[model samples]
Target: MLREFHVHDRKALLDAATQQGWDPLPAEELDEDDLHDVVGAVMWLADSGAEAEGADGLLDLGKARRLRSDEGHEVAQWSPEPIMEDFGKGWLHRASDQPGDSDQSEERTDFAALFAAEPLHCDDPECEDEGCLWQLTPRTADLLHTALTVLADEAYDDAEELGDKRLLEGEHEGNWGVFARMPKLTFAADLQWRRRFARAADDLADDLEHDRWPQPTCTAEELALHFALDDARDLHDELGYEDDADHTALPE
Candidate 1:
């Protein structure tokens, strides 16, 4: 059976896992066979340690479902890349260092470019003119910092594990700099990216606030809530679909 736990932070996540009789399993350490046991185990951390603090809700990977549409068809899947792309196209507009089909490893500037973009402006009337650009909410700042740190750390660890000398320490160090000094001005920029993505997400839904939701809607937020409530997990387990190798595959 799947278990749900409220982890207030990264250390709490690890502590909970240890108490539950499992070691802290990093994302790179898991294989296909470990998905069932490990996804909900530590996968929640991928969202950001900030999310672990309960601002984003509990860790309940056992309940996630593909967002669906009004026609009973699944909606487009959400991923971070497109949002990153929008960060460049809509905001930063930085010149591509290696344009065209350059591989990701060769074109690692996206992270920095996105990070350097201006932050979202605070909507508070008192802070309107001055803007929260220089003073982002702690939660927002933590989320971005954690995302950069975790990504860089995982990449560095992976490089070391593979004994890839081509991966230099400078790469990790540069990302660490951004992680450490991310300013609030950049929050407005990132917030815009999120707002655009959220709007795109909303367009995919039939009706988000409907009374009979959990049905016509397919927003990531709603699905997340359903997972938190264990409704999705119970339905998934009851249907015997949880055991399938491709449990996440959408219907044709």
Candidate 2:
């Protein structure tokens, strides 16, 4: 039935409509306009589509097509790309650095490309904990900053977890440079210190990648959102100690 519509076989559609007892017009008495109208209505019956589940009303037209179409035929079985199948229903990075097909990884830039700065000295000698620091590129930073802020704001008008704590001793700089001190972040009890860091990460990403969405949806925003979730995972260890982070979290 669907094959008729896919191939635009109006004659086949008319035949199917007659077999199903759905003919609305007399074939022998009809003018060309009447036949056209009946065929067009049959075209709709061929669709038989319904709401796609769990996609927030995004139509899953392909699913309906696959189901109603004959399974015995090879054409009915289609598949998505392998990368999409394994990428955690995840996303691809936008503004991508296209690699040569000869050897895709050969010219690939290392993760260091994300950094804008590196801290030479240990941020805290007082606690005797050793550390290294690297800042994310401004583009990457905005992506991370915005996604986390959006998620956090959706959770709280003034989220404590989104506190922009100062990680290093230098003047506030880089994507990771949130700059609030730890009291609310660590203790989660100090209202005063909590007040300091509140809403720091909010609106961080609004002007950057988010506003440009659909004009050109940025892949960095998705990556940043995942990274922020990682930071939020171990809240117990993160309390009061901003320097304990092995690597940076979603930046300020």
Candidate 3:
């Protein structure tokens, strides 16, 4: 069924299920809705230029429960999270690494500062006056964000997992706490910090554009990633969790 999309490179993905030990729909059942979804997902993956080899790990991300906007574009990443606290402000963007990481571990060297720094003024998130908010220093923010990102990931992993797609759109509107769902964005909850986070998200989007990052396509994988990243950043939010805003992060 996926072959109807005319994606020449799909030999890899089509054959992937066999190697991964999942059975494709039988020829007689090719017209089933489930098969159609799987095929559509595969086509979307093909359009997004995703490498299907690594996908051998899991195939359910493109499933119905995953996140994807109505647009063909997937929200694979949230590239700007201007974390603020008593420590001050620092930029954060996820790279499919733990949301705790400033970048990847290889790209990060804040450990020396992170370890030497003062412990969060209040390690307890539920502490009175919120001492945890004071720990938002660059190093501390990464540390804290990492901790929250990890904890959330663990809890949600029991929840589920998905791969990265990449969302780095244009200038996000911070006023109403709205950011680009495509490219990289979403509501930050703290309306005051929304401006900075919006800028940061825009800058990250620019960088991705300059680097020629691939645009998202209408595929199962890309769609799954977009929803995943959106959910990931929402977990560590200082304010916006309950205000009827959407904050999604990756499960995997």
Clashes of each: 12, 3, 20
* TM-score for each of the candidates: 0.19, 0.19, 0.22
Whole-model Cα lDDT of every candidate shown, in order: 0.35, 0.38, 0.37
The order by descending TM-score is 3, 1, 2
How do the residues 87-201 of candidate 2 rate in per-residue lDDT, one tens digit apiece?
3454343444333223332332222334434554665545433334343544344334434554434433232343444333334223222222222234333333333232223
Q: On residues 126-149, what C-alpha lDDT tens digit does candidate 3 reach at each position?
A: 776643444323333332333333
For residue 169, model 3's alpha carbon misses the true position, in angstroms, by 16
Best candidate per TM-score, number?
3
lDDT of 1: 0.35
Show model 3 residue runs off by greater than 4 Å. 1-8, 19-22, 32-115, 118-176, 180-252
* lDDT, residue 222, candidate 3: 42
**Over the stretch 168-201, how does candidate 1's per-residue lDDT look in tens digits?**
3445445433221223332223322333323322
Q: Would you list the rank order by lDDT, best first? A: 2, 3, 1
Model 1, residue 133: distance off in Å is 44
Clashing pairs in 2: 146-205, 186-239, 186-240
